[model samples]
Target: MTPHDYLNIGAAVWLFVCWVGYARFARKRARTDHCLASVLHVYRKTWMIEMLSRQNRIADTALIASLERNVSFLASTSILIIAGFVTIMASIDKVYITITALPFANESMSPRQLQLKIVLLLMIYVYAFFTLTWAMRQYGFCSILLGAAPAHDADIGEAERRRYAISTAKIIDQAGHSYNYGLRAYYFSLAILPWFFNTWFFIVAVGVVVGVLYRREFHSTTLRALVRDLTATEAMKKSPNG
Candidate 1:
């Protein structure tokens, strides 16, 4: 293999490592840290438990439907993107010429190499489509779980009610996680766009993507506000007479 081929392999490896590594780090850190996922997980549990107190659950079901719609939209978009990639794969020569024509014209890689990059992007979107669809299905399951919950006035024990609510929330949490993975696919796919230019550009773009994801997930303004609100609510719940 040429040096450029080796660089391509190394860059691809770096992309996956950064992507997967950040996922693992976030998963572990979320157990103790205040990130979007953790904060949202807490809200999910609270929402599920609170839902048991309402005689009518129209609002709860509507909320689940909203989540399902969002996932469905992304899944549909992923299909369109995957189809675009497939079309591009069959016409790499034109793409190759277009890339090389640019002034900064990239690594002199052949059309075969460009096709490989496109295939990688296709695989990413395909994974995104599957994850998004799975998230939509999970949301559907959550709706059913809500429907099957014990009625508000049912004589269930407090412990049993809590147990059921927590378990149901776990389903929603899994759905949210699947949806997050789908989004991560979209983020990393942008990293591949720079690959058509050169491996160095590709590597740097991957880092940029990872950095952007890390900031939004852990340090964004929204996360701060959520954590603050949740903290205040928890404090209120523990106060005397609360």
Candidate 2:
């Protein structure tokens, strides 16, 4: 293999490491840190608890439906993207010509190399489709759980009510996690698009993607606002004004 081949291999490996490593890092940090996932989990629990007081659960179910719709939209869009990629696959010759003309890629770029890059993107979208659809189904399951929950005026014990709310919120949280994973795949996929032009560009893009993800997940303004709001809510709950 040539030096260019080695660079390609190294870049691909870097992408794999960044994608998997960042996912693991983010998840572990979320357990002990104040990221969007962890902070929103508290909000989900509070939402479920609030549902316990409403005699009509239409609003609760409606919220669940809205979440499901977002996942469904992404899943369907993934299918369309996959289809477009498939169509592109049928015209690999044109892709090879176009990519080879790029100053960075040049005439030495093999058709197989171009095909592999496209396939990598296709695989990402396929993985995203599966993850998004599963999340959509999980949201549906949350709705069922909500439906079976005790009525507002039921004789259920406090302990049981609390347990039920916790379980329902857990389902919603997990579904949100799955949705996040799907979005992560999409982010990484964007990094790969540069590979056909330059391997080093691809590697740098992967690092940039990781950086963006970390900042958004852990240090975004939205996260700060959510954390602040949650803190105030907890402080209010502990006050003795009542």
Candidate 3:
């Protein structure tokens, strides 16, 4: 209704656009480029290849179990956070009073406005919960695939084994991607917190959050290292003896 309201809405839209747009861009680049996700994907494929060559797979199973446990823990945490948001929504009057008393918080938020803000937080956590649960399920599928994998001494052809390894590795990679999405939701939720203070602060928070994500995803030191490592590996493969 007001300029501040329009700015708040604009900030929210911008946050959503950045979140979804970056995810798509990263996914595309990860197929052939050197970034964190792409590097990790290469490792996943290598892990599967190693598993195919190993006679003992206990350690491999343990590693997959550990990944599943991590996803489960995050899913549980998201549920708890959603419940906390609901609690806050139920006691929004007290929350509004407390927040308005803070020196920097906007004092003009009506009950409806407060409720909307709380709902936004709740929705973000809900989305995170679903993403994490889906990741957990994918990890479960990975475990199943691992269990069904042919042993190193099996009579299966090498080509078949390699295919199985690549398929399983892709599944695991997807699970990791889903987990990353859930974590991104948590990051953006933090950006939404400043909206309760002022629209301008909310916009600034959105920019800061997106900037942080962009830098980490595309320009971090870790990415550079991965690129260098990948390049060296490719060079080695092209050598006469390789």
Candidate 4:
């Protein structure tokens, strides 16, 4: 098989592994106690909302903890670099094949194509790495804040407690969005790289995958509920009681 073929196979296998991981996470969540399970359930649901609408709501402490755990995996950054290397190799190999099959020497290549490939690969890496690093830093900050949160029966002032809670929630929510953006970047990088092989097929395949992912994230019941909850909260905050 060609290098592109290998990459396509690798992508499929990675996707399957991710699916299994998600399934296991779901099962583990189901087996947890009601309170903890409910918290994670909502936290997971918020990501769906963010995926669909590119917006998220700050809800509970459990959500913050869960997002922190997920971000610590650094899945996006790792995947981006790994897949980007594979794509770069595939393009290079194809170029090698072109040179070898020609009538003349196989060593020479256009500077423009080489420069373009390097630029694209570096762009993907930089985008992935920057976001991943930021997410990791924010995760650490969230962890510190979570550790410092007051106990349920603490005698802290209501305003002070509320401020802490809101700030923590916002940090976690921002982390979730950052993680999502990183994942999107990784996928887009892989999808776009195939254009060097064949533009039309890569574009169509990428479009379909993107469309499916978007619909599942945004149109799901969980996301709709979260959206409603956020809207209601905003409305209440605008009122005098809030």
At residue 188, candidate 4 shows an lDDT of: 61
TM-score per model over all chains: 0.96, 0.97, 0.93, 0.53
lDDT of every predicted structure (CA atoms): 0.92, 0.91, 0.88, 0.56
lDDT of 1 at 58: 98
Candidate 2, after superposition: displacement of residue 162 in Å?
0.6
lDDT tens string, model 1, 187-226?
A: 9998887777668988999999999999999999999999
Q: Put down candidate 4 lDDT per residue, 1-242, tens digits, no spaces.
A: 56645554455444434434543543464355222223434554444333222222245445556766676566565666667666666577566566446564323334344445445656665776677768877877876765566665567786776666666667765665567666666666566554444445455656655655455454556656765776686689699989
lDDT tens per residue, model 3, 1-242: 98766766777788788878878877887676567887888889989998999999999999999999998998999999999988998899998899998889887777778888889889998999999999999999999998999989999998999899999999999999999999899899999888888877877887798789878987899888877887898789899988
lDDT-based ranking: 1, 2, 3, 4
RMSD of each: 1.2, 1.2, 1.8, 13.3
Query: Which is superior by TM-score, 1 or 4?
Result: 1
Give the top-scoring candidate (TM-score). Answer: 2
lDDT tens per residue, model 2, 33-117 = 9999999999999999989978999989999999999999999999999999999899999979877877767355589888888
Model 2 steric clash pairs:
none
Decoy 1 TM-score against native = 0.96
